[model samples]
Target: MPSVTTPPADSLLQHRAFVAFWFARIASGFGFQMLSVAVGWQIYAVTGRAFDLGLIGLVQFVPSLLLALPAGHVADQFERRRIVLLGQVVEWIAIALLTGMSLAHGIHEVGILLLVCVIGIAKAFEFPALQSMLPALVPAAILPRAMAVSASAGQAAMIMGPALGGFLYVAGPGVVYSVCGALYLVSVALMGRLHYEQAPPKREPATLRTLFAGVHFIRARKDVLGVISLDLFAVLLGGATALLPIFARDILHTGPWGLGLLRAAPAVGALLMSVWLARHSLQQRVGTIMFAAVAGFGVATLVFAVSTTLWLSLAALFALGAFDMVSMVIRGALVQLETPDDMRGRVSAVNAIFINTSNQLGEFESGMLAAWVGAVSATVIGGIGTLAVVGLWMGMFPTLRQRQRLHVEAAAPADTR
Candidate 1:
């Protein structure tokens, strides 16, 4: 992989491979979002149980925890392009199998669960390898901008995927799943065009010892640990996405479009923030900014809990997304800067697990709490819990408070001795 010391804004645009990768990712993300909504809708229509929905989240998350390190090991031992290509192949096969099952009209709940589980397995390997490949496409200096671009692309897909999925579900879930499978095939084709400088992995034995080394490396560094923990707790508590459909139906008293707006608000906010951040990176006080942003997210969540008006709720969710984007940018930059090249796969694997695991756990927590304490109370309590987590993390990691931008140069052995 080539590393650029200085990257101009035009660099990413100038590279045809990078452009191809970005567009393919955008299309693939859109397809996946559609698949999720279609699958969840079908499951709920069949089971009519909230916990069943929560289980969808759980199934997706379990693979990340179990396979993250192994996936990382494979990523480290192979060419990243091949790794990503393999993921695309797996995704398409999973979707094809799912579509076939759905069209057969004899598919049961267990069958749907199995397909969703397979999707999760594919994702477990896909995200970390894709993230680790970022530095190979763009220079170190423009990494933040590159990340912002990718984030914005995903946000754009969020805007289109769900609304379209909802409309297509009315037509037929099998149709939506088939379309999604086709998109995956297209993504595979697009990814095939990406060309990168490749090198062979070290011949040293790949073992659990190396996996533990990655965990040990992250745990030993206060800076790295602080960033990961901040994200883990903040997102775990502040994520209200799991409860949105309930709010849209009961609290806001709005129809599908309104629900779509509520769903899209955060992405809209994140997309705008991403565009702004691309123009000027957060190269100063990145850690403080992350904390402050999370605090704002908590505040926004609290506001949304109390709001009845659709527009007001939308505003709150938008604010939450803006804050979430800040945390995402800072934490991602910190990880990219602190982790070594050889360790990137394993470290990013751990990071992916924490991030996705929180999302699943958060969904379960939010769903269960909402069932127990009612929706409003559950959301409010979660918001408050997120604030508490931020406060506690700040007290424990004083280094984060005095931080600046990440130093993109390779870090020393992280003082693990």
Candidate 2:
């Protein structure tokens, strides 16, 4: 193994493969963010139903849940970049279908949702392959900085994409979908430029046991389990993004552009924090910092729930995003560093499921709860639930609470049993 000098934040941009991969993330993330804003606005406009907004998340999540194990296996068994390329192709086709539907102007909600499911399938496979490929792109010493830089790029896209989507939506839905498709094309081109040699995969026979190995690996690693699960429940309860349409149109009485600003607020905060973290890595008390971030996220959610003033709401959202970014950086570094190389795909797949559950299922939960109570009350209750979860987790997982550092030795193959 070659010694990797810990490069300064700007110098990390010089690594060719990492740069290509970073660009790929930015392009894809921007397109997806635009698609999210467009879809939420379009669906709410057509149906005037909050549950339908939740259904969008549910529709996408099912494919990811069903394909999680198979997707991970495919990543481990095949050329990881090829799998990502295929996933992008699938996304392109889905976007094209959506564009055609928007151009036709029939407003088929079910059709739009069906296309979202296809995108979800693409995401299921792509996420693990992309995550597992990262360690191969840069040496271990720079992995945390690389993760921070990659996250910052994604956040930058998130900030721009939603605002751009809102502005483009004024022209028409067709325009937004067309632009999103073009961005995916750019991402495909960048991903094609990435070059890395993966080790030959072990010739393990496919079996039920093999498919579930990732689950077993996570179960055995208590620290990994604790960190991921903490994120899972906290975000599941605290997530307010699903109800932003309600907040913008009904609560704040803002239009589509206002919705875009609300959506971008959190990413703006995350981007600033990500840039800072890229320069100054968190070197000690990693677990404690993550817990504090989650608690702060809950506090911000509570503040946002009650604020009728748009500026106040945006401020609360910015705080929420800033805290969530801290947790994201720490948890991401832990997941990649702690898992073995051969199982990276599987472990990443499991992590994806946890994330998807927190986000998608959380959306579903928020929608249902909002339907039961009002959106404001549901959001407040969620904030309370999030704070409670953090308190419970801190008590339950002492090892995670006391963990002091983010660095780990290089992953070696280990027994699955």
Instruction: Tell me the lDDT of model 2 at 279.
Output: 90
Model 1 RMSD to the real structure?
3.2
Top of the candidates by lDDT: 2
Candidate 2 per-residue lDDT over residues 1-417, each given as its tens digit:
334344565767778999989888988998998999899999888889999998898887788899998899888888899999999989999998888888998767898888888899899999899999988887776677778888998889877887799899998888999999999999999888788778987767768887888899989987789889989998899879899999999999999888978988998999998888889767679889989999999999999999999999999999999999899888888888888778888889999889988987788899999999989999999999989998998998887888876664443335242
- Local accuracy of candidate 1 as per-residue lDDT tens digits, 1-417: 234344555777887777888888888999999999998999998889888887887788788789999888777777777888898888888788878877887667788888789888888888778888776776566677778887888888888888788899887888999989888887888888887765566644677787666688889888889989888988788778789999999998988778878888999999999887776766678778888999999999999999999989999999999888878877786787777666778889989878877887888889999999999999999899989998999899988876765653343334442
Candidate no. 2 TM-score: 0.86
Give the TM-score of each candidate: 0.89, 0.86
> In candidate 1, which residue ranges exceed 4 Å CA deviation?
1-9, 43-55, 101-108, 255-257, 371-374, 411-417
**Top candidate when judged by TM-score against the true structure:** 1
Extract clashing residue pairs from model 1.
none
> Which stretches of model 2 miss by more than 4 angstroms?
1-6, 36-56, 97-114, 169-175, 245-259, 306-308, 370-377, 411-417
